[model samples]
Target chain A: MSPPLAPPGWSRWLVPPAALSVHLAIGQAYAWSVFKPPLEAALHLDGTQSALPFQLAIVMLGLSAAFGGTLVERKGPRWAMTVALVCFSSGFLISALGAWTEQYWLIVLGYGFVGGIGLGIGYISPVSTLIKWFPDRPGMATGIAIMGFGGGALIASPWSAQMLESFGADPTGIALAFLVHGLSYAVFMALGVFLVRVPRPADRAAAAGGPSAAEGVRVSARSAVRTPQFWCLWIVLCTNVTAGIGILEKAAPMITDFFADSSGPVSASAAAGFVALLSAANMAGRIGWSSTSDLIGRKNIYRVYLGVGALMYLTIALFGDSAKPLFVVCALVILSFYGGGFATIPAYLKDLFGTYQVGAIHGRLLTAWSTAGVLGPLIVNWIADRQEEAGRHGSSLYGLSFAIMIGLLVVGFVANEFVRPVHPRHHLPAPPKEAADVQRQQSA
Target chain B: MSSDSSPPRGTRNGLIAFAWVWVGAPLGYGLYELVRKATQLFTG
Candidate 1:
């Protein structure tokens, strides 16, 4: 059956809020840390044990996104958003049950596996539709939606913390928090599902002559994965993300370690402040850098992100402990690049491969994030632990990690330089009956 | 892009306002925390 398009009177601008509603709600994933300490104390689990739900959720996010990408493209945003709502909210409800029953593995299955699928699907649910709706400003359109992901934790952190504080951190309290989160997000995401509308072929045809012109080689997701350009970008995204996450995963502690020996040491509260600043920088950078991409072009903006990103890391590696403000400013800029990297990539995919299956392609590309999520934290934390064990103090503890980050950013910069337009051979040929059949089977 | 097939300006305006408020409520809350945290960081 053909999908319904926006009515003649529909406003394109409303689509962004539809996207943001889901992104903002699912972005609560980032706030999982707020529950960590409480879960550990209440459940009598170790830090690593308590972290299983979150870790598994990330793993599931990548896998589900990879497996579900084509389905999202085939099924449409409303269907994808509905599935995301069901899986995501139910994951929370199930986690609530798990918590109440004191079953750690159930929490892992509920929040990790089930909720992770919600995250993956919810994350990519709006990309292609948004590109179609605002083809003239794909970057800015996507930036607005993706920015909510970065900002999700900011709202969730305080809210979840307050819930835990008010309701008590015990299993019942945590379960109630989960229940509230699940139900509210379900309602929030439903708004997106209702508001989202697919662009009809007629609207697309009308758009072709104007700012929304289709001027690039369009590849199907299956063909896109086969192109060298996709892998190059994969390398670029992975390395850039790895470099940023190295600092992010350890932001609070890294700041304290850097300023430990200063005349006025950074207190724990101040360290938390540093984290909040990074979050703000991250959110700001998404909208700021992405909108700039629409002006300067995507490639140029990425050069700034990857190349200048390396320089920012070098600044910290050399002069980090020399001045606290320098450290803070450098960290903020690096974090902005991190956020920008994420917000820009969907638009970048649109630029390279066109909007045909950009959402599915994007879903596949997120595996890089899942990979970087592990590699980044592992590299930084492992090195930091070893340094501390060796009695290294202060800035030296992280100096090595920062230098390594510089090297990785430079590598990603080279990869970005090598990224070229997808070759014509990779483009999906004019749709034929047999080709449609093959495509259907492939997506199936 | 031309608005030949688009909604009226008033409807668009109302929608833009509603859309902003819908997403902005949560985002505004987040920004409020951001401001609070920034204040704590700089004041000390």
Candidate 2:
């Protein structure tokens, strides 16, 4: 093949499509919950048991991203995107085989383990690249890519539901849906690979290692751990995700249970609607809330996400079991913030550490999500499960969980407050503007 | 964790700046609303 035409522009535009492809495809993980009731009913599994696929996916997302960060950064976006596509699509295929065989563990292994790798790699691939492209607006660039991740569920949720309805809820049907997903996504993600391009030579030469490089925003992964900023962000994200996922994991039944004896109760259809609304908010948060991080500074924006998010959780815990509209709205608002937290975090990382090795640092940071994924669900589900066994009704079941969430938030708030400027020793000056000069010379 | 700044300024195209604002605003507004509502839940 002829020498690859030097990708025109900063090749930054390629970053969004690349990020979105992985995000949108792996986003199918969020739709795992919709499959649980059917799987449980069909296979006679318990709620906890059926949740394996999603939990595994979340776990894998963190693990892969953590390990793969360096690979993506070194190998370049093309390699990373390709790996994401294959693993993600293959996970579906394996899960399809499991569905056909009525082997639940196969589903767990295929969709959860193998597929999780895709989720993790796909997540980190575009972030560092985007920062490289938009050194001036690290927050905005990362936000755009991350938004794709949050929004992917919007398309996947309904699409999965529809597929299941058409295919029949049995082993054969579920398998068919999984098969279709695998095939379709391979095609979708391929679009990204074909389109993506690394930064041109001139651009790299121009910077010659500057501070503004989004990669340089933070310390090296090793050094980063020693910094307070990383831990502060960890607390902020963990708490925010914990609060949001706390509500999201229980969104359907949580509202209806609260209203079971209330003056105005939530109907089944309304519960479904509530789930849909939350999805909308989740998608919107990825795009809308994160981009905001660009303007306001990632640190200040996170303060709002954590501090305000706490209060919302408190409202639902305190008064949620009473008012129907208030309960629904507040929970949703919290979920939106939760989605925003995921979307905005990359930008936050960019602000703290320079973009050098940001992909790796971000990969490391996502271990926080993995931790929260377990913590959030366990706290909510375990507490509710205990309450149900103890003969408590409605509000009492969630009181303890909500209280725990509040404490997490308060802790997170302190973490956010603890954030100080990066110590000077870790500093890397911004890349000099040679690319601009080159462009000026070319134009003149 | 350095208190350093990098001005790796790319081409100052109004095009990119315009695109940034267009995309960033909605995200900002969404976050602002979430915070505003979370705040209002108490004060309002």
Candidate 3:
């Protein structure tokens, strides 16, 4: 289908909400933990078995975004949003059927494989459109949309908990809840599909007149992966995410363990609170730090994320057990940087590669997230397990992991320093008149 | 391509506000719930 082109004076402000509709719906993936306990009890499964759907979903999110990105670019935001809506909402319905029937693999296939494609496509569908709309404030524009992904769990967690409480956590109730989610999100995401529009070519050309246009260096996604700059960014993103996600994945347990030997032992309720606080920080950092990136530039902001983030880990490792308040503050800052890293990266890609196929490039870059998603938890959990085996307790169990995170951050910092503008040879040559005419006609 | 057929300024303004409210209301509720939960970190 031809992408919808905006008439002159369609307010740019409308785009963020359109983007949010899909993001908030797909972002519910993070709230999978709320279902874990119930699913386990219902299916008589272990933690790892219950976690398979979420893990597969995340892995598929990366793979689909990488493979489907060019298709999204060619098809436009409306097509992408519609596809996301169909897949995401239907995945929930299929999961509902699976729950009712007590078939485990069906749940994985639905929520993990199909729903994950929705997540991947929905995540990037708005990115290039927003960047195009708000060329003057690309960081803030994309940040607003991406922040919804981080904040989605805030809504889904409490809502899901309340539903489970009301409906009971049995297979029937789970099926009912999934059914509701499927129908409701289908309705919500339809708004985005209806509202999205691509900037007209004239508008795009006008926006490209800015100074940072890098003399019109429009790197295609295939070519973008070839540059040293992309790999450097890959390392930068992987390390930054690895550091933050390690603490995030283990927040409740890590906090409790940090103070296990102290005067103020953390209660279960307080650990839950700590996790909520980190979620707030993560959401806030997406809008806050990414907007700051608009003013200070992407590279300088990442220096803070990596450099200052590593220092926060060092402080937590050394003095965390003694001071609860200090530990919380350090962790909050680090989590914020984690979120900021995600929100800011698309703007960073726009800066380095220009906006040619930025959505596709951004899609490919998310492989770093998939990598860190596995690596972060594995590092923290594996090390903590080994330390437990060695008779370590409290803060000692996590000190080695914290130190390793510091090393990883240092590596990321060096990678960020190595990033330069893409070479001119990588830039796409200007399209021939017939091709440009066909593109414009298709968009029209 | 400015058009005389465009909606009036007030209509456009109303749309902008409505769109923000559609997304913002849910996000606000989520944040309020999160803060309510997060308070336990200090009080608990």
| 1 versus 3: better TM-score goes to | 3
What is candidate 3's lDDT per residue for A1-444, written digit by digit as tens? 788888777777888999998898899999999999999999898999999988888988999899999999899888899999998998899999999999988899989989988999999999999998877788999999999998788888888889988988999999999899899889988879877888865566455453335425689999999999999999999999999998998999999998888888999989989999999999999999999999999999999999999999999999988899999999999999999999999999999987779999999999999999989999999999999999999999999999999999999999999998888999887567534743565465
- Of the candidates numbered 1 and 2, which has the greater TM-score value? 1
Which runs in model 1 stand beyond 4 Å of their true positions? A205-216, A430-444, B1-15
Return the top candidate by TM-score. Answer: 3
What's the i-RMS of each model?
5.1, 11.8, 3.2
Worst 10 residues of 2 chain A by lDDT: A1-10
Give the alpha-carbon lDDT of every model: 0.86, 0.74, 0.89
TM-score sort, best first: 3, 1, 2
Q: Mark the regions of model 3 whose C-alpha exceeds 4 Å error after superposition.
A: A205-215, A432-444, B1-10
> Could you tell me which 10 consecutive residues in candidate 3 chain A have the lowest summed lDDT?
A206-215
Query: Residue A40 CA error for candidate 2 (Å)?
Result: 4.6
* Native-to-model Cα distance after best TM-score fit, residue A168 in candidate 2, in Å: 3.4
Q: A1-444, model 1: which lDDT tens digit per residue? A: 234467765777778999999999889999998889988987899988988888888898898888899999998888888888999999999999998998878888999999999999999999899888877777898999899988788889899999899989999999999999999889878778777888654454444433232533568999999998899889888998998898899998898888888898888778878888898999999989998898898889989999999999999989988998999999999999998989999989999998889999999999999889988999899999999999999989988888888888898999999998888888775456534543444454
Best by lDDT: 3
User: Candidate 1, residue A75: CA error in Å?
Assistant: 0.8
DockQ of each: 0.33, 0.04, 0.48
- Candidate 3 global TM-score: 0.95
Candidate 2 lDDT tens digits, A158-181: 678888999999889989999999
